[model samples]
Target chain A: MMKSWDPRIEEMPKEDLQRMQYRLLKSLVYRLYSFSPFYHDRMREQNVHPDDIRELTDVKKLPFMFKRDLRDNYPDKIFTSTKDELVRYHVSSGTTGKPTVVGYTQNDLNTWTTSLARALTSVGLGRGDVIQVSYGYGLFTGGLGMHYGAERIGATVLPTSVGNTERQIELMQDLGATAIACTPSYLLHIGEVAEKMGVDIKKDTELRTGILGAEPWTDRMRTRIEDWLGIKAYDIYGTSELSGPMFTECVEQKGFHVWSDIALVEIIDPKTGESLESGQKGELTITILQKEALPMIRYRIGDITTMDDEVCACGRTHPRIQRIQGRVDDMLIIRGINVFPSQIEYALMAIPEVGQHFQIVVERKGALDDMLVRVELTKESFSDKINDIIQVRQKVEHRLRNSLNVNVTVELVEPGSLPRFEGKSKRVVDKRSL
Target chain B: MDTQKFVIRQISIFSENRPGRLAAIAHALGEENINILAFSIAEANGFGVVRALVDYPEKAHDKLFSLGYNVAFTDVIAVRMKDQPGGLYEVAKVLGDAGVNIEYSYAYSGKEGAVLILRVDQVDEAIKKIKNSGATLLERSVFH
Candidate 1:
């Protein structure tokens, strides 16, 4: 039988869900127009009033919010709720610019936790299951978000925040953790540490499910993790701006189900700033209809993915967004071709001789763009014959050229030479910018 | 005579071509008191394969590998040549005429005689051709 934390909302009819979204969006617009000066001035500048947002599609009338808006507001200038109403604050570490602070009222926290509860339940995790939260805690939403959701689902929570992999593996064994939530890279790191410790995760540990997100990963990586560690890896999607890791893929693992009651998602053509129909790939824009402290209306999240309105096989009625292809800013234009690091990873993972670590270096030589992919050769693939190594490099170059539609120079580096990060790994080095 | 006894193990290390990389490798081998008999560096794009004949090939490989170097053992034939002009020509002509392709070759002259280490495409065929051509070949025990 199917299990859901909130069956009423998760299984609501399509028409009813849209109607509820429209109602919540209307009140949210009206509240912001009346109370928040930032939203009011932006709306007035765009000549959009609360009355303009009558139908659900009328959301197009409002101006799109941006990460810049949050940065410009800095600490909490854009928040609609008052300081006394906020129960907690989670600030995103703005690596590019000023950090954006998110304030959460008690109800806002409940809504965030409830969204995760439904998501966790949809993935078939509850009670008796031990979920190890491996995402970093504190200001980052990944840890606390999964932590609260796992706890709410009646599961035993093991708050093992990132790092100390050996110990995390020890706890995973000693505590008999059944599931873990963390970045895919971190999970891979744990697997390596476990193997080095002579602890076979598949045979010894009870871990079976992984909620991996917070960075872009490929389906090939999913297969590798599943086959290697003997775990079902599910992709979780959310940003700190949207209440921090809210929705995740159910056991079917098709895509992440974005709950309609909490937030409304839209795929928009990033260049023209126009909404696209379902199943068309574009930038992910969202409207947090029920967020009180910081309500985001048509916020451009900048992630590129397609949305599927068709209900999932899991029997949930919420729409599912496909796995994030790549971020808008992360997309690289090499020799007039759109290339993504994830695509390179996908292609590299397919080749048996290629290792997991690779770095892309892009530079402008004269008038042309030159891309060089530095791939680490796995120990298993290393050969004594120089001709064999040359063949591997040529094969890698050929595969990358076919996948990316751009000529690439492949350099076979020694294993463990490339940089490895505990969190998100920065694989691209664009020397052209410098 | 069994030519297999003449096949010697050559250690090849993959390294990025940069300053002090060779010195670092040499220092590590020196720390272990391993003598490099004959070595050749092959260069490609920004990387090099350091192929060497050492007295203690197994020990050198382990030390270098334990130090995180990508090391592999390749079977190469070390042929004894006359320590005079055309000494290489005699061996090169014999292999070329026998339809054996030498991938790479390095030579070192000691007080005894000049020895040519040939990395050939076909190890067994090269050993048989060299031995059949009346060319004296050094046994693996000579290097050890």
Candidate 2:
């Protein structure tokens, strides 16, 4: 691992990275002018021509294009290259009316694979390993990105898609997978299934490592997963547009290793438009530099992250990022307090008897948002004394007040009552009557 | 630091599996206005033993016996511990090699030091061994 593809590129001393970034920005200004109608019209209105932009410092001159603009443009208006050059296409397909379609050029695909490969390797998965890609296959980047990375690493790949928990167990046991990849929440579901079928996940399965991502989780969830699954769970950081997981958890598991070799991540204050210093939390904006075909420059992704220039315990010199707290879109601003549903979910995870199946109900009450968390009791919990269950509920509600600093009502429902997702789990139900 | 102050009492409590066990323990001492300097619990296969070293050693002994639940006042020291991993290791390793077994122990966070409630096989001998090992023993001043 001495001096990755370009040590100076990965380590490109902040000042040097700035110099190279400006050089790349100049090219972005030219490309945006040529291909994107959205950017071409904006640059003209701002009187900011490609020629006026000299270096990376001139990034401020480029007007930001948001996810909305991409959605409004739909299939091809936001695309820079021709449909023929677009080797791959993925859509957001979120519950929000319109799904943003993003296309990738052939070279863009290569950069994505390299980034995904780096993430897989960060978790110690390489040649002679068996990786079961359990993330869904089409219209989503998680499955394919993991598929190709396992392929690139020359490891055996098992495309298990999403559910069929019983079959997943059958394959995991029969195939003897060394590493499993999927959402952390779904992994817990599988853990429950194994317990029901009387399979000791620790002894029955040869699973030594797992790469769980595509959803945000807490450190408490990490401990629960490790103890339950009997494997070290590494968080894989990715998005459909930014070419899949750019960061992967190293052995230290403190923070994620940013694939800075190909991508440049900058944490900037949304209001001031200034780069927040290392270790401060803010909105994250990314620039896809050096992708021969589809190059993105200073694109704001709206992800909130804890960024620091501190060197990690893993010995990599690249800047590391804390696991994403929540998307700016996912945040619920209740009476001016920023509350991510993941934070609520994390509070629920701390109640071990409560397990992972839970939902957050956000409602407007007297000009303020009132929170209610409804969690399902595990079979193991039901078999225990009834009085302990009520105490757990009280503890969960009390902890939510301390952890979230907001009042919450915790309700314990019977098992199998809450909805489980075959796709993405919709845990947050916002019922604000504005 | 030994005979001049403090009393170690083994307080037995019958706690039904319910909320406010810790709160009840806090309230029981609150009624008598006696302060607990250090405490620990060792749960049997069924019941739990709550041992406490309280301030107003004589009053705490009278208060627990009056409440009634097989409470015994014994000779136990309030040993000091560092809030670190090897901190426990050093004490445990020394007593282990000395053939002195720590039967059960309890702990609570303190402002200056983490207070330990240890029930060892040899109380008087373990106290001397712990003091010689350079560990500080807390006094009634903590409860007061």
Candidate 3:
């Protein structure tokens, strides 16, 4: 059966979608230039003015915003609203240096909540489903973002947050929870813990659907989670700056449909900053159409993916992305070969002997670059026999070499030897000094 | 005879091959009042394995483990030999002729002459060979 949370916008005609975008983009540009000095200076430097944007094509005249710009303006310089206007805000823990802060007015919060609710409904989650939001809460937008969306959908929401896997399973079983929202990695972790406790989630619990996002995961990982928890796994995509988890995969599991009425999405060539044709892979750029407290104009999101404008099987007209490939910063180029850690993760996860805990170490040896994948063997796969262990390591090495098209050295370590992360995990350690 | 009483449990700790790792292990065990009677360190690649005979093998294993060191116990035979030249060769030759491969071996001297610790592929067969050769095998009680 097909369903939609907002049929009017979801089924809007192609011309109407473009007309709506043009109307929002023209005003958004003029408003930002008038209110936010950051945008005004950037537009001025680019020799663009509010009068320049007359048609949708004129959006190309506006300046692009990057993470560096956000860092340079830190705190509240980028905000269009004053202190009295912002009802709530979230700050990203920069980890490197200065943090990027985003503010939200009451109307902006309502839009964010509705956008998320629409995303959730597209994936067949609504009232009567007990959803357990397991994404971490607080400064990170993932937890509360999904929490309010589930509540807005009228679905019973259990704000379980993250961690305490054993008790999480108990609550799910006892409460008959039908859905869960968390990082795909954490969902898999809960499944592992459930298995240890002799609880077969697939057969014993009522979990039927999982809303997973915040980290790039492979289709293979989705299948693994679905098999483990007996749930339909859907990919949700968003950034803290633009509002968390605004796009999600429909029941078809084809791609995540971006809510074009609220946010404008474009795929651009990362190096050239030129927009690419539909079905062509490039860096994803987003612009908030209705955001008031902090509007983003042509914001380069750093994610790489292709956009499909074709009408979906579920009857939604909003353009969908063909899965997030990888972040531009997360891509590694070794000796003319481009490889993504997520690809390596997919290859490793497909092998039953290899556990999820693995790290890629890139070092320079003489003039050549070397990539060493150090992964841990599952406890059951860890054997005392030297020949058996060697064969396992060789199998992993051969699999990686075949998949990546690059010869990589695979080192097998003991279980629990590699580092584990609660949030977005760091899988690469580059020592090339290049 | 209970093999637990006769067999000497040698604690082997996996450590990175760097300075102060051995000293750290020594200090940790010493703090627990667990004396390391005889110890040998074998290193390969960038990691070293510290195999030691302590007064209480279980106690030392727990102490080393709780102190954040990867430690395990292996049952090794401690055979007493005359503290003279070729004392090791005599014991090695017997185990070699018995077709038992010696993975690793360490030696230490005490008031009761020299004792050689042997970690072989076949512990039972090597024990039989030592018994037949009249080489005195030091039981766990002798360490006490």
Where model 2 places Cα greater than 4 Å from the true spot, the runs are A1-19, A291-295, A331-434, B1-144
- DockQ measured for candidate 1: 0.29
Separate DockQ for every predicted complex: 0.29, 0.01, 0.06
Error of 3 at B128 (Å): 48
Best candidate, DockQ: 1
Alpha-carbon DockQ of candidate 3: 0.06
Query: What is each model's TM-score for chain A?
Result: 0.78, 0.73, 0.77
lDDT of 1 by residue, A1-434 (tens): 23988888888999999999999999999999999999999999999989988899999999999877897788899988889999999876442324579999999999999999998888889999999999878877888999999999899999999878899999999999999998776787788788889999999999999998886678988999999999999999888899999989999999999999999999999999988999999999999989999999999988899999998887889999999886777666564234668778878888989787899999866434689999887667777667778888999999988777568999988777889978777899988631
The true-versus-predicted C-alpha distance at residue A268 of model 2, in Å, is 2.0
Better of 1 and 2 by TM-score: 1
Candidate 3 local lDDT, residue A237 = 83
Q: What are the Cα lDDT values of the candidates?
A: 0.87, 0.69, 0.81
Q: Please report the candidate that would top TM-score against the real structure.
A: 3
By TM-score rank, best first, the candidates go 3, 1, 2
Model 3 segments beyond 4 Å from truth? A331-434, B1-144
Model 2 over residues A177-270: C-alpha lDDT tens digits?
8889887756777788888898888899989788877665678888988987789999877666676655687777877877555666778887
lDDT of 3: 0.81
In model 3, the Cα lDDT at residue B63 comes to: 81
